[model samples]
Target: MTQERVAMIRERLQQALPVQHLDVEDESHLHVGHAGAKDGGGHFRVLVVSDAFDGLAPLKRHRLVYDAMGDAMRRDTIHALSIRALTPAEYERETA
Candidate 1:
Protein backbone atom coordinates (compact mmCIF):
# COMPACT_ATOMS: atom_id res chain seq x y z
CA MET A 1 0.00 0.00 0.00
CA THR A 2 2.79 2.41 0.83
CA GLN A 3 4.58 1.64 -2.40
CA GLU A 4 1.41 2.17 -4.38
CA ARG A 5 0.76 5.49 -2.66
CA VAL A 6 4.29 6.63 -3.34
CA ALA A 7 3.93 5.71 -7.00
CA MET A 8 0.65 7.57 -7.21
CA ILE A 9 2.23 10.68 -5.72
CA ARG A 10 5.21 10.48 -8.05
CA GLU A 11 2.94 10.04 -11.05
CA ARG A 12 0.81 13.03 -10.14
CA LEU A 13 3.81 15.31 -9.63
CA GLN A 14 5.43 14.14 -12.85
CA GLN A 15 2.25 14.76 -14.80
CA ALA A 16 1.75 18.24 -13.32
CA LEU A 17 5.35 19.43 -13.38
CA PRO A 18 8.51 19.05 -15.40
CA VAL A 19 10.15 16.88 -12.79
CA GLN A 20 13.87 16.39 -13.14
CA HIS A 21 14.34 14.50 -9.90
CA LEU A 22 11.87 13.15 -7.40
CA ASP A 23 11.99 11.04 -4.25
CA VAL A 24 9.12 10.14 -1.98
CA GLU A 25 9.64 8.62 1.46
CA ASP A 26 6.92 7.15 3.59
CA GLU A 27 7.16 8.29 7.21
CA SER A 28 3.86 7.01 8.44
CA HIS A 29 5.51 4.80 11.00
CA LEU A 30 7.09 7.83 12.62
CA HIS A 31 3.63 9.14 13.45
CA VAL A 32 2.23 6.03 15.01
CA GLY A 33 -0.67 6.68 17.40
CA HIS A 34 -1.05 10.27 16.27
CA ALA A 35 -4.55 11.59 15.72
CA GLY A 36 -4.27 11.89 11.98
CA ALA A 37 -2.69 8.48 11.71
CA LYS A 38 -5.87 6.86 12.92
CA ASP A 39 -7.54 7.62 9.61
CA GLY A 40 -5.02 5.39 7.77
CA GLY A 41 -3.46 8.18 5.71
CA GLY A 42 0.28 8.07 5.30
CA HIS A 43 2.86 10.71 6.06
CA PHE A 44 5.42 11.40 3.38
CA ARG A 45 8.43 13.50 2.57
CA VAL A 46 9.27 14.48 -0.99
CA LEU A 47 12.27 16.03 -2.63
CA VAL A 48 11.33 17.42 -6.03
CA VAL A 49 13.77 19.06 -8.38
CA SER A 50 12.28 20.82 -11.39
CA ASP A 51 12.85 23.79 -13.65
CA ALA A 52 9.26 24.76 -12.93
CA PHE A 53 10.40 26.13 -9.56
CA ASP A 54 13.16 28.34 -10.99
CA GLY A 55 12.02 31.72 -9.73
CA LEU A 56 9.30 30.79 -7.32
CA ALA A 57 9.41 31.66 -3.63
CA PRO A 58 9.27 28.89 -1.01
CA LEU A 59 5.56 29.32 -0.41
CA LYS A 60 4.84 29.27 -4.11
CA ARG A 61 6.96 26.19 -4.54
CA HIS A 62 5.02 24.42 -1.79
CA ARG A 63 1.78 25.52 -3.38
CA LEU A 64 2.82 24.01 -6.67
CA VAL A 65 3.56 20.75 -4.91
CA TYR A 66 0.24 20.81 -3.10
CA ASP A 67 -1.58 21.52 -6.33
CA ALA A 68 0.18 18.64 -7.98
CA MET A 69 -0.93 16.38 -5.13
CA GLY A 70 -4.58 17.25 -5.97
CA ASP A 71 -7.22 15.08 -4.26
CA ALA A 72 -4.78 12.76 -2.54
CA MET A 73 -4.58 15.22 0.31
CA ARG A 74 -8.34 15.65 0.65
CA ARG A 75 -9.02 11.97 0.12
CA ASP A 76 -6.72 10.98 3.01
CA THR A 77 -4.20 9.15 0.87
CA ILE A 78 -1.66 11.69 2.08
CA HIS A 79 -2.17 13.11 5.53
CA ALA A 80 1.06 15.01 5.96
CA LEU A 81 3.66 16.02 3.41
CA SER A 82 7.11 17.40 4.02
CA ILE A 83 8.24 18.94 0.74
CA ARG A 84 11.60 20.04 -0.51
CA ALA A 85 10.94 21.73 -3.81
CA LEU A 86 13.87 23.05 -5.73
CA THR A 87 15.28 23.86 -9.14
CA PRO A 88 18.09 21.72 -10.52
CA ALA A 89 20.59 24.40 -9.65
CA GLU A 90 19.34 24.61 -6.12
CA TYR A 91 19.44 20.87 -5.76
CA GLU A 92 23.01 20.71 -7.00
CA ARG A 93 24.10 23.49 -4.70
CA GLU A 94 22.43 21.90 -1.72
CA THR A 95 23.83 18.47 -2.44
CA ALA A 96 27.30 19.84 -3.07
Candidate 2:
Protein backbone atom coordinates (compact mmCIF):
# COMPACT_ATOMS: atom_id res chain seq x y z
CA MET A 1 0.00 0.00 0.00
CA THR A 2 2.77 2.41 0.84
CA GLN A 3 4.56 1.58 -2.39
CA GLU A 4 1.39 2.12 -4.34
CA ARG A 5 0.88 5.50 -2.79
CA VAL A 6 4.45 6.45 -3.58
CA ALA A 7 4.04 5.22 -7.15
CA MET A 8 0.88 7.20 -7.60
CA ILE A 9 2.54 10.35 -6.36
CA ARG A 10 5.59 9.77 -8.53
CA GLU A 11 3.47 9.07 -11.60
CA ARG A 12 1.43 12.20 -11.10
CA LEU A 13 4.50 14.38 -10.79
CA GLN A 14 6.27 12.80 -13.71
CA GLN A 15 3.25 13.22 -15.97
CA ALA A 16 2.68 16.78 -14.88
CA LEU A 17 6.23 18.04 -14.36
CA PRO A 18 8.59 15.87 -16.37
CA VAL A 19 11.22 16.07 -13.70
CA GLN A 20 14.90 15.70 -14.48
CA HIS A 21 15.48 13.70 -11.34
CA LEU A 22 12.93 12.18 -9.05
CA ASP A 23 13.35 10.14 -5.90
CA VAL A 24 10.62 8.88 -3.66
CA GLU A 25 11.48 7.17 -0.40
CA ASP A 26 8.96 5.37 1.69
CA GLU A 27 10.00 6.37 5.20
CA SER A 28 7.01 4.59 6.63
CA HIS A 29 9.14 1.86 8.12
CA LEU A 30 10.90 4.43 10.24
CA HIS A 31 7.55 5.42 11.62
CA VAL A 32 6.15 1.97 12.19
CA GLY A 33 4.23 1.66 15.49
CA HIS A 34 4.04 5.44 15.55
CA ALA A 35 0.89 7.49 15.59
CA GLY A 36 0.85 8.40 11.93
CA ALA A 37 1.39 4.85 10.70
CA LYS A 38 -1.17 3.50 13.05
CA ASP A 39 -3.73 5.79 11.46
CA GLY A 40 -2.99 4.54 7.92
CA GLY A 41 -0.91 7.60 7.20
CA GLY A 42 2.69 7.15 6.17
CA HIS A 43 5.88 9.17 6.25
CA PHE A 44 7.53 9.77 2.92
CA ARG A 45 10.14 11.97 1.39
CA VAL A 46 10.39 13.20 -2.19
CA LEU A 47 13.12 14.83 -4.19
CA VAL A 48 11.98 16.29 -7.51
CA VAL A 49 14.07 18.26 -9.94
CA SER A 50 12.06 19.89 -12.68
CA ASP A 51 11.98 23.07 -14.70
CA ALA A 52 8.33 23.35 -13.71
CA PHE A 53 9.45 24.64 -10.33
CA ASP A 54 12.12 27.00 -11.63
CA GLY A 55 10.57 30.15 -10.30
CA LEU A 56 8.26 28.88 -7.63
CA ALA A 57 8.79 29.72 -3.99
CA PRO A 58 9.45 26.93 -1.48
CA LEU A 59 5.92 27.13 -0.12
CA LYS A 60 4.49 27.11 -3.60
CA ARG A 61 6.44 24.03 -4.48
CA HIS A 62 5.06 22.24 -1.46
CA ARG A 63 1.61 23.49 -2.30
CA LEU A 64 1.90 22.14 -5.82
CA VAL A 65 2.83 18.73 -4.50
CA TYR A 66 0.10 18.74 -1.91
CA ASP A 67 -2.34 19.83 -4.57
CA ALA A 68 -1.32 16.90 -6.71
CA MET A 69 -1.92 14.56 -3.80
CA GLY A 70 -5.48 15.90 -3.40
CA ASP A 71 -7.64 13.36 -1.61
CA ALA A 72 -4.68 11.28 -0.59
CA MET A 73 -3.92 13.66 2.21
CA ARG A 74 -7.50 13.86 3.34
CA ARG A 75 -7.89 10.13 3.34
CA ASP A 76 -4.79 9.63 5.52
CA THR A 77 -2.95 7.84 2.76
CA ILE A 78 -0.10 10.29 3.28
CA HIS A 79 0.43 11.86 6.65
CA ALA A 80 3.71 13.65 6.30
CA LEU A 81 5.73 14.41 3.18
CA SER A 82 9.14 16.02 3.14
CA ILE A 83 9.84 17.46 -0.27
CA ARG A 84 12.88 18.96 -1.91
CA ALA A 85 11.61 20.67 -5.02
CA LEU A 86 14.33 21.95 -7.27
CA THR A 87 15.38 22.74 -10.81
CA PRO A 88 18.11 20.65 -12.42
CA ALA A 89 20.66 23.32 -11.71
CA GLU A 90 19.69 23.65 -8.10
CA TYR A 91 19.78 19.94 -7.61
CA GLU A 92 23.18 19.60 -9.18
CA ARG A 93 24.56 22.49 -7.19
CA GLU A 94 23.26 21.03 -3.97
CA THR A 95 24.75 17.64 -4.71
CA ALA A 96 28.10 19.16 -5.61
Candidate 3:
Protein backbone atom coordinates (compact mmCIF):
# COMPACT_ATOMS: atom_id res chain seq x y z
CA MET A 1 0.00 0.00 0.00
CA THR A 2 0.98 3.59 -0.44
CA GLN A 3 2.43 5.55 2.46
CA GLU A 4 -0.77 7.56 2.61
CA ARG A 5 -2.83 4.44 3.09
CA VAL A 6 -0.48 3.23 5.79
CA ALA A 7 -0.69 6.57 7.55
CA MET A 8 -4.44 6.53 7.36
CA ILE A 9 -4.57 3.07 8.86
CA ARG A 10 -2.27 4.16 11.66
CA GLU A 11 -4.35 7.26 12.31
CA ARG A 12 -7.55 5.29 12.51
CA LEU A 13 -5.96 2.82 14.89
CA GLN A 14 -4.67 5.56 17.18
CA GLN A 15 -8.04 7.27 17.21
CA ALA A 16 -9.96 4.11 17.93
CA LEU A 17 -7.54 2.78 20.51
CA PRO A 18 -6.78 6.15 22.11
CA VAL A 19 -3.21 5.22 22.79
CA GLN A 20 -0.89 7.37 24.88
CA HIS A 21 1.87 6.88 22.32
CA LEU A 22 1.80 5.33 18.88
CA ASP A 23 4.55 4.90 16.34
CA VAL A 24 4.00 3.28 12.98
CA GLU A 25 7.15 2.63 11.00
CA ASP A 26 7.14 1.44 7.46
CA GLU A 27 9.85 -1.13 6.80
CA SER A 28 9.25 -1.46 3.12
CA HIS A 29 12.88 -0.80 2.26
CA LEU A 30 13.95 -3.85 4.20
CA HIS A 31 11.58 -5.98 2.16
CA VAL A 32 12.63 -4.70 -1.21
CA GLY A 33 13.05 -7.50 -3.81
CA HIS A 34 10.84 -9.77 -1.70
CA ALA A 35 7.85 -11.37 -3.37
CA GLY A 36 5.28 -9.49 -1.30
CA ALA A 37 6.55 -6.05 -2.30
CA LYS A 38 5.41 -6.69 -5.85
CA ASP A 39 1.92 -6.02 -4.60
CA GLY A 40 2.93 -2.65 -3.14
CA GLY A 41 2.29 -3.75 0.46
CA GLY A 42 5.09 -3.91 3.02
CA HIS A 43 6.26 -4.64 6.52
CA PHE A 44 5.54 -2.42 9.49
CA ARG A 45 6.46 -1.92 13.11
CA VAL A 46 3.89 -0.61 15.59
CA LEU A 47 4.67 0.65 19.06
CA VAL A 48 1.68 1.57 21.14
CA VAL A 49 1.02 2.63 24.72
CA SER A 50 -2.45 2.44 26.15
CA ASP A 51 -4.33 1.81 29.34
CA ALA A 52 -6.48 -0.63 27.43
CA PHE A 53 -3.54 -3.05 27.38
CA ASP A 54 -3.38 -3.20 31.15
CA GLY A 55 -3.73 -6.70 32.59
CA LEU A 56 -3.42 -8.28 29.15
CA ALA A 57 -0.72 -10.78 28.39
CA PRO A 58 1.79 -9.93 25.68
CA LEU A 59 0.28 -12.37 23.22
CA LYS A 60 -3.19 -11.02 23.88
CA ARG A 61 -2.06 -7.50 23.22
CA HIS A 62 -0.53 -8.53 19.92
CA ARG A 63 -3.67 -10.45 19.04
CA LEU A 64 -5.80 -7.41 19.72
CA VAL A 65 -3.80 -5.37 17.23
CA TYR A 66 -3.81 -8.11 14.61
CA ASP A 67 -7.56 -8.35 14.99
CA ALA A 68 -7.87 -4.60 14.63
CA MET A 69 -5.90 -4.70 11.40
CA GLY A 70 -8.45 -7.21 10.13
CA ASP A 71 -8.51 -7.78 6.38
CA ALA A 72 -5.34 -5.80 5.81
CA MET A 73 -3.29 -8.76 6.92
CA ARG A 74 -5.33 -11.33 5.06
CA ARG A 75 -5.23 -9.41 1.83
CA ASP A 76 -1.50 -8.71 2.10
CA THR A 77 -2.07 -5.01 2.40
CA ILE A 78 0.22 -5.41 5.35
CA HIS A 79 2.79 -8.14 4.83
CA ALA A 80 4.14 -8.19 8.35
CA LEU A 81 3.61 -6.23 11.56
CA SER A 82 5.89 -6.10 14.58
CA ILE A 83 4.00 -4.85 17.58
CA ARG A 84 5.16 -3.57 20.93
CA ALA A 85 2.26 -2.78 23.21
CA LEU A 86 2.64 -1.27 26.64
CA THR A 87 0.29 -0.16 29.33
CA PRO A 88 0.77 3.39 30.61
CA ALA A 89 2.38 2.14 33.80
CA GLU A 90 4.79 -0.05 31.89
CA TYR A 91 5.68 2.81 29.60
CA GLU A 92 6.37 5.17 32.47
CA ARG A 93 8.53 2.62 34.22
CA GLU A 94 10.55 2.00 31.10
CA THR A 95 11.13 5.67 30.51
CA ALA A 96 12.07 6.35 34.09
The TM-score measured for candidate 1 stands at 0.97
Q: Backbone clashes per model, in order?
A: 0, 0, 2
Q: Between prediction 2 and prediction 3, which has the larger TM-score?
A: 2
Model 2 regions more than 4 Å off: none
* Deviation (Å) of 13 in candidate 1: 0.5
Tens-place lDDT digits, model 1, residues 1-96: 999999999999999999999999999999999999899999999999999999999999999999999999998699999999999999999989
Query: What TM-scores do the predictions have?
Result: 0.97, 0.89, 0.86
Clashing pairs for predicted structure model 1, backbone only: none
What lDDT tens digits, residue by residue, belong to model 3 across residues 1-96? 467757866876776676898888888899898998887677888888988799999998988788778787877578888899999999899999
Predicted model with the maximum TM-score: 1
Report the backbone clash tally of model 3.
Answer: 2
* lDDT preference between candidates 1 and 2, better one: 1
Error of 3 at 74 (Å): 1.3
Backbone clash pairs for candidate 3 read 1-40, 1-41
C-alpha RMSD between model 2 and the true structure: 1.3
- Candidates by TM-score, descending order: 1, 2, 3
